[model samples]
Target: MTMEPIGTWHGVTTDELGCVTHLELQDNRLAGEIPPELGSLSSLVRLELTQNWLSGGIPAELGNLKNLFSLSLSINQLTGPIPAKLGGLSRLFTLYLGFNQLTGEIPPELGNLTNLNGLFLAHNDLTGHIPGSIGNLEGLEFLALQGNMLGGEVPPELGRLADLRHLSLANNRLTGRIPSTIGNLEKLLDLELEHNMLGGEIPPELGNLANLRSFSTRGNDFVGCIPAGLRTAALNDLAELGLSYCT
Candidate 1:
């Protein structure tokens, strides 16, 4: 219960915390680590230590916080890896390290945070592949690398995330097929490639995802049937369609 040391004590008021610039200590049960002098708070901009119980390993001096833009260390109990100097926080736009216990890989320098729009590394224990420099994060719009233990395939350069909208590589250990340039993510809406080891068939150009809403490929190794434009009506905002244990 003696946490102090965030910055400028002696009577508070940089809005009750001294020279503050948005530092939300989420779920405040804050534990340890994460104080490399808070990277000298070079005018921080949104740093929320999420759902506390924090452990160590995320302070590569926070890349000297060149004006951070939303960095939430998700549900803590942190582990290693993931600090490729936080890609030097080039004005990061929301980077939440999901449900912690993090491991290696996934840091192709976080694709140099091209004004990233939400990139949460799901669950954790991440492995390799998936970082074709994350297709240089073309203004990414919510991409959770589901569960984790990620394998290859699926990165048809993430179809160049033209403002992607929720694309989870479910479970993990991904395999081949499914990337017909992912129908160019026409603003995709929830497309989790169910438990991995994927196989051929299913990409009828993802029925040109007319803003698909939740489309899982079930336990993969797909074989056929289901791609009738993802069962017509241009996916009519389909609500959770998992191709039950594909043939």
Candidate 2:
């Protein structure tokens, strides 16, 4: 068998109609931007290019793939907003686009991907609020949106996602009270909401998150005491529930 391209020039060897099922180019010194032509591969399922030096925006043509399941492009230098066309990927499960220079709002169109599981868009320059459409993701498990400039209230619709387990929304400029509907997320285990401008009472409904183990909200503008139920109920792991600057 001929030697396969292993390190930097891996994707360069990918041929059209090569029937590749899994393409993992993560952390192999792959530099430069992703080729837009790769979208022609209709058979691709898992495509991982994380932890590389890849730059430039993700190609909008990637939406052409109707069978892609996992798409990982994290820890790269990719810039520009996520393409709304990516919403065409209905079967996608995991989407990792963190640690980049991506800007603009979280696309509401992404909510069309009802099969999505892990949605990682943290450590970028993204702005705007969490889209209410995200509640349409009935299968989402992990959602990370920290270290950005996202504003606006936590969409109450997010509480509709019964499968959500991890949610991170710290270090942003978000305002408004914590949506009481969040208490409906019984599967949530880790919830982070620190360093924001949110105010108003902590919703009593959150006390219903019995699966919640870690909750943080430091340096916020919240007023009134902690939710009575949270201070005394199943969520009373006070040490693990770091709170600060509540009015």
Candidate 3:
């Protein structure tokens, strides 16, 4: 007989003062709405409950975790808009709320998280333009906003993230030309913008992103020859290139 995947929730940790600091319960077979009382864990530093069967709107009370550094609740059946109150997380480093049934536009209040390093909100029902305020995150390294219903032009402000390594805005309803500003992310490693309505020639400035490895603009209205800089194999050791259906 096959053994059941271990579902015991056992990574709880506490500080010397007896305050709960970490609670990890990924794949724990949890169900029902998250408890609002969890917000009372005033000393909590990290809380993760990914890959479970939880549903219902995310409790706004979670925003009360003033000391939280990381929060992961992906791969669940959660719904409703992300809590704008979460913008108050001044010390947050990584925030993962992807692969849920969340709706509504991402709250601009999230821009207040200047200490954020990674932000993942992909594969949801989110709509509206990419928030320009996100450019305020000077230390951000990873940003994934793919597989949503967001529209509008790619914000030029995104180019401001100098430390960003992975940037994906793929499989959305975004329009307009690829911004030249993106080339400024010299640290970018993987960039995907496939299956959108974006047009115009791929910016030649993109060739300047020496660190780009996986690049795709495969399904759009773009016209013009692929830039010569992209044809060179040595300059950008790309592991994957999806230039189909757009050239």
Candidate 4:
């Protein structure tokens, strides 16, 4: 568990020897809820249970793992809201909990993980506004929260995450304008916001993004010119922009 394990999911049969540090149980027939006893493994570092039939909300005991780094529980039948205590894992780097039946707004406690690099919470029935506390994740590079019923404005606090390279908020019921503060994301490479109810000028401030390579507004009600800085930059010069009209 101290040693980092590699390789993709191979189902429940993956070796669980005490000395065997890494294990992946993705895309398998392993049914039933995640075992609470599994949290007793003090050495486990990465646990991926994606693309399975595993049901039930994540066990609160998972917060007991101090050494855990990567935890992916995406594409499953799990229900109920995310465990708020998950924010206690200061060492966590990547957390994926997409494509589930989980409801409720994202826990603000997640902002406590300053070391997190990737965070995914898409395709669920989640409601309420995105938490502004997420702006505290300075190390966050990838953020995905598409295909949900999430509403409310994108938090301007998120603009503080200079390390963010990818941002996706597509297919939600979100309203309000894209924040001008988004101009702060100088390293962002991709920004996706399709099928939402976003309006107001596409903040020209977004043009400040020097690395922006992809931007889309397929079904939103955005009105205004593309940011001049982005339009003139070489990054957008070769980029394929996506836009559509829905009257």
Task: Give me the candidate number with maximum TM-score.
Answer: 3
TM-score of each model, in listed order: 0.35, 0.88, 0.89, 0.85
Q: Relative to the unseen true structure, what is the C-alpha lDDT of residue 68 in candidate 1, on a scale of 0 to 100?
A: 83
Ranking by TM-score: 3, 2, 4, 1
Tell me which of candidates 1 and 3 scores higher on lDDT: 3
Best-first order by lDDT: 3, 2, 4, 1
Which candidate would rank higher by lDDT, 2 or 3? 3
Kindly report which residue stretches of model 2 are placed more than 4 angstroms away from their true locations once superposed. 1-18, 231-247
Give all candidates' CA lDDT scores: 0.80, 0.84, 0.87, 0.82
For model 2, residues 178-235, the per-residue Cα lDDT tens digits are 9999999988889888888888878878878877777777767665556544543333
Model 4 quality (TM-score): 0.85
Backbone clash pairs for candidate 4 read: none
lDDT of 4 by residue, 2-117 (tens): 34343222422223453323447788776899998777766767887889899988998888777789899998999998989899999999999998999988999999999999
Supply candidate 2's per-residue lDDT for 132.
97
Query: RMSD in angstroms, all models?
Result: 14.1, 4.2, 5.5, 5.8
